[model samples]
Target chain A: MLRLQSVRKHYDTFDLDCSLEVKPGMITGFIGANGAGKSTTFKAILNLIRIDGGEITVFGKPHTQITAKDREMIGVVLSDSGFSGYLTVNDVAAVMRQMYPLFDRADFMERCRQFGIPEKKKIKEFSTGMRAKLKLIAAMSHGARLLVLDEPTSGLDVAAREELLALLQDYLEEQEERSVLISSHISGDLEKFCDDIYMISDGKTILHEETGVLLDEYGILKVDETQYHALDQTYFKWRRKESFGYSVLTDQRSFYLENYPDVVTEKSGIDDILLMAIKGERL
Target chain B: MRGMLVKDFRLLLMQKQFFVVIVAVSVFMIASGQNTSFIVTYCTAMGMFFSVSSIAYDEFENGYAFLFTLPVSRRGYVAEKYLFGILCTGITWLLSVVCCGIYEQIVRPASDPAEQVLITAISGLVLFVPLAVMIPFRLKFGADRGRIVMMIVTALLFGLIFLVAKAADSFPVLKQAVRAVNGLSGPALSGVAFVFAVLAMGISAFVSIHIVEKKQF
Candidate 1:
């Protein structure tokens, strides 16, 4: 379990003030565009960057109070963050074994074999996908209770991504108390795996909700100008004009179905919600 | 702490400077032609340089970050570094002594007692004190910038020393004062001075660990 409360950080042109929580046994997807404070938040939580305000806690302990033993339960994978390129996969494994007491050498070697990563090959010579896979192997082999991954699938091919997703699904199924917080640009992967999604924009959380609840509560309604005027403004989360009519996002789908039988209503996808939230447009 | 030390040793094994220091000491021992004092002094200076450069290498390689993330505490890291420096200097000093002993058996067949003891003491103090003072500063700032600052400071100190030596040579009263300071003769006094220097180094090392622990990556 993780909680970030009123965490604020400032740069020359951007400011971050956001709060969120990741409950155990849930896979939470952090979705945002580039430079949307995802990496900053992760860095702050890891103490790689100093926070100007607010507190972060993991497993009920404050960030600073979390001892090295506490960190044993946390596994992290950062995009493009690693050791020198000259190190081979085996070298990395050895180094990690030294750093983590829970590190299983057999599991790590097995993962590398499963992922088709050669132990003797230098990381600099590996493709981006291979590098990502190596990092994932390193993070997962330690039997961590909480996995924090930043764009772990950014460079993978479709097959590799599917394999990774399947692995994650199996991993979650096996461990009931384990939780994961992942940020990715690929919405479809998140849609398939994440139970909850948090949409972040401009350093603030725009929406945070259960995926099923979101789909059940929100609906896209196609209405003509007249019908749009008749609809209550309070019900619209986002609305936009089309050539023939308007598409309105509303929380009460059942009410729209009963009240306006002729209007077309459909379930909105995560991408649609994300686009509308970020663009600040209403239909 | 053991993990960090093992990793540091592995990294040090890969470094060319380690080999360079070894070779330089060997050559110096051979070239000294059974001169025990020369061998000890040369090896001590080489050990000092090697210790400083190894610390620089650790920083350049981002080794500290990885080390800190492990279960080892900040104080432990500092303690390990101090131990490493002392261990390396001791080993190099021992090797030099062995080589000198071997050469003495082959050629001179006699040991100069006063010269041997003086060289060992003076060389150890000169090398260890500078290294102790500089390592914490280097770790705090960085390798390149820290080295530059250290060079400037050393230049200034040497300039002041040169001026004082010149003044003492020209003035009888100043000469007497210098003689009085240097002429104090007792192994007990030297032991006390060595203990004080080691204490200062220990305190500096502790302070360095505190600073590093509070640093935000």
Candidate 2:
């Protein structure tokens, strides 16, 4: 549903060149450290910030050409921005009612009630978890075809995060054509939720892999200097120097498991993959 | 646009206490026999400020980013603010006029209520001049810095006005021009002010749209 091809944005201190794709009915997770250009990528896709070069298309049209009507199908949850803090939930609902013809106000309020979001209190007065919930609710309430979520689970508790992920799963299950592009610091959330994952670092996309491949095939292979020298290096993606010898990241975990039985093969999660991708040296 | 209007109006309602204070102060001043024209202008100016302040609220805590993420275009956002500004300022102008008219009848029966209403109505148009200028300033510099910039600009404006008055006092050509302006009939003067106000608002809105369109977030 969305594609960004080498989208470029330049700032005084940072420059971004990113490429990503979210296919229909798929959930794509974006993982990066702070200031790694995840939010910039999201903003570029939304056309909130002007890109220096490259092209972004949403729903088969250039992002710049997407009209307000087209945006009605795009649900967005920004990390540090939201409805004006002065507005209450009721006020936001009233505004949403006008903005989206398909906005499910009843569903929105029911979700709010389910989450214990008070309808009368100013959003600024809401707790961080409550505010996060409200943003999620708003994004999910409208019958959007795609959701561009930046840190949607940032302030929520563990249970709340699980609840939100479950809700997202429900949202996707309800519509076979729907898609989501989400970024979060919490790798576990992405691991449990995303169909595919993109790893970004220093404003560039460093890795993109299906979540199952990343988890099932990718691994950290710990080896002393003797074993490292003896083992075949064919599948090693990255290697980092360690006190004992080296920590090698391999994409062919089973190959190592079957061939090099003595080597320690630890299954790599999203966090482990991100660490290796960022800190390890290519072999 | 309608969604944006609802958001801005809802934001303005957060300061319901300010509305009460404005009304209470206006009523108190009118009851104490203060100049009705000043009261009307005071209420009108105060009410118009809410529209300008809505810009600040939209910008608070990085709210503008999310606002644009909604189904709002840059031009539509600017249009909504202008429309809301007119709606807010017009309502207050009407309310102040009614209050002043009532006060004129009950407390100052000797005063020409019709003339007072006319002067107050014209002042409403003049009031739009500042609203016109403030929107672009606020949009360009943001809220806190915009307020500081506005104070400096207001000082410069007053200085310019004083200089013009001094020149009018000394130069016959300038003095005659000033006298001509002062001599125009009430309706004629209001009509001119209306045109000037509309011109200023159009330029201000244009500049504001440019500011927003060029903004990164």
Candidate 3:
């Protein structure tokens, strides 16, 4: 539903030059470290900040061409910011009623009640977690087909995170045309939820692949220094030196296991793959 | 845009102290008052500034980031602010004028109540709406530096007026122009002021839309 082509934005301390896509009926994950241009990319996509270069489109139309009517189809949640604190739950619903023609007030109130949010209390008096949850609920309560969530699960507790992720799964399952593009620090959740994952570093897209292919095929080879030197460096995708031994991340796990049975080959998760990709040396 | 106004109106209603101050000031001005115009002036000014307070709340605690993420355009947001401000300033202006008229009829009869009401309403229409619209537009700092910006703008405008008057004393042409304007009929003066206020409001809204669209959250 969303496509970014050579999207670039320059800041004083950091810059973004990344390209990625979120296909329909999929949950595409954006994984990166803090200040790694993840949020900047999100901002640029929304046109909250002006981009220096490249094109961004939502549902085939350029972001600039997207009108208020077009924007109704997309929902966005920024982790670092939120709605006015002085507003109450009722007031927020009232606002939604006016903004969206299809705003489901009953469903929104039901979700709020299920989430234990009080209707009369001003949101300013709410705790950090509560305020963050309010934003999430507001985003989902509207009948939006595309959700662009930046660090969506960061503010929640473990159970709340699970619930939110579950809701996202249900949302995707409900329709084939629906899609989500989310960035989060919780790699484990991304592993569980994302169909395709994109790893960004230093404001660039370094890797993109299917989550299953990455987890099932990609492997790490742990070996001692002497053994590492003796082996073929040509085969290892990237190698990292540790105090005990050198760890190599490789896409050819089967080859490593078949040829070099002695070298410790273990299944690699998204985090492990990303860290090695960021810090390890390439062939 | 309607959503933005919904949010702003809710914020405005939460100010209990502001309401209390308005009622207290109106009572004092009417009870032991010199003129009912004071009540109209005070209320109109209060309404104009109160419209800005909604912006303050919206920008407080990094609210604008989330605000713009909603399905509204930046220009729509600006237009909504102008509309909301006009609504608020209009309400207060009307309420103040009606209340003053009532006080004049019941508490103290004015020599010419109709003329008084006309002047009060016309002054409010010509002065308060443009001030309310433009001042909020110029306040880049939203809530934090809003008062400071308002004060600076007001001071500069008065300074400019003073300089023009001082120059008119030395320049016969300037003096003649000023005299000609002053010598116009009452209705003609009001019409000129009305057109000036409308033009000023339009320009303010146009500039505000440009600035707000370029603003980075």
Candidate 4:
């Protein structure tokens, strides 16, 4: 379990103010556009970079109080960085064996083999997909209870992404109280994997709800200019202008459908939700 | 700390060909009866740069951001660097000593004075290495920035020496102090140098740890 409470890190042009939680046995996803503070929140959570203000806790321990032994249960994968590119799979295995007292070498090697990674080949020569897989392999093989993955699905093919999601599912099924906090640009993957999704924009959480609730309740109502002029804006989350009408995004699909009997209400996808949240004006 | 050291070792492993080239050059020098002390010095210097290279490698693509995400603490990272510097320097010194020793036995017998100087240099490596590495690390100077910082440091040293020389010329006590240092016996001078080097290295390690603590990443 992980909790970030009002975490804030300052920058000249960008700032991160995040608060979220990864409950036990749940996969929580942070969805954002580029520079939406996803990676910054991850860094602050891990204490890789210091925060200006706020608290981060893992397994009920503050980040400061968390010891190396405690970190044994935390596994991480970063999109911008990883194991040194010059190292081979075997060399990384050796490093991991030294790093984690309970490192499963056989399991690691077997996963590498299954992933089609060459033991002798340096990671620098590995393809983008291979490197991503290698990172996942390292994270998953260590029996970590908390997996914090930033852009874990990047550079992976569609099938590979599905396989990775399945692996994560199996991991949770195998262990009780396991938690994962993953960030990705790919909304579909997040839609498929996350129990709860948080939409971030301009360094703030604009939307947070269960995936099923979002899909079942959230809708876009398309009305012509004349109809839009008569519709109440308070009922919608945000409305985007179209050539002939306005498409209103709202979580209360029944309200719009019941109130405006002629308005077209369609189930909103994650992509549409993100776009409206980011680009549409606030009420 | 052990994990970080292993990572550095694996980084150096990437340069296996570079080590081969070093071996080839050393052999050519010994066979040609060239000054092999240069080789030893080169190898020692290589060790220093190699340690620096490891730090630079760690910073490559902001890799430390990921590395610290693991269990290792910042103090642990700094401690690991110091140990790795000593290890690399010691290994290079031992390799050079063995090769140079073989050359002495088979080709040119090492003179007493020359051997003594070589022994001193080899032993000084332990003190020299950590200082060399710690300062660069404290400054957080990457490989390219290291050269620039080195130039700036050299200029500052030159300026300090110039001011001291002027003071010595102007003041009788300064001249006397210089003479007193020059008049020390060999053993006493060696003792002074050893003590100074140890003190400097101790300060370097302390300062480097402070720098790491102050650092955000």
Query: Of the candidates shown, which would achieve the greatest DockQ relative to the real structure?
Result: 2
Compared with the true structure, the alpha-carbon lDDT of candidate 4 equals 0.82
Candidate 1 segments exceeding 4 Å error: A84-86, A121-125, A215-227, A239-248, A252-267, A281-283, B16-29, B32-69, B72-83, B112-118, B163-181, B184-193
Those runs of model 3 whose alpha carbons end farther than 4 Å from true positions after fitting are A229-235, B129-139
- Per-model TM-score versus the true fold: 0.83, 0.97, 0.96, 0.90
lDDT of 1 by residue, A26-52 (tens): 999999989898988877776666788
lDDT of 3 by residue, B101-129 (tens): 88788876645786777678667877655
Question: Candidate 1 or 4, higher lDDT?
Answer: 4
**Two-way TM-score contest, 2 vs 3, winner:** 2
- Model 1 lDDT at residue A147: 86
- The 10-residue segment of model 2 chain B with minimum total lDDT is B26-35
For model 4, residues B74-132, the per-residue Cα lDDT tens digits are: 77787787778778876887778777766666665555655545454645444473455
Ranking by TM-score: 2, 3, 4, 1
Reference interface contacts recovered per candidate:
0.18, 0.83, 0.82, 0.72
Total clashing pairs for each candidate: 4, 0, 0, 0
Instruction: Give the per-residue lDDT digits (tens) of candidate 1, residues B58-143.
Output: 55445444344445566676777877777767677777766665666677657654545555665565567776777787777788
lDDT of each prediction vs. the true structure? 0.76, 0.93, 0.84, 0.82
**Candidate 3 chain A least-lDDT 10 residues:** A229-238
* Lowest-sum lDDT 10-residue window in model 3 chain B: B130-139
What range of 10 consecutive residues in model 4 chain B has the weakest lDDT sum?
B129-138
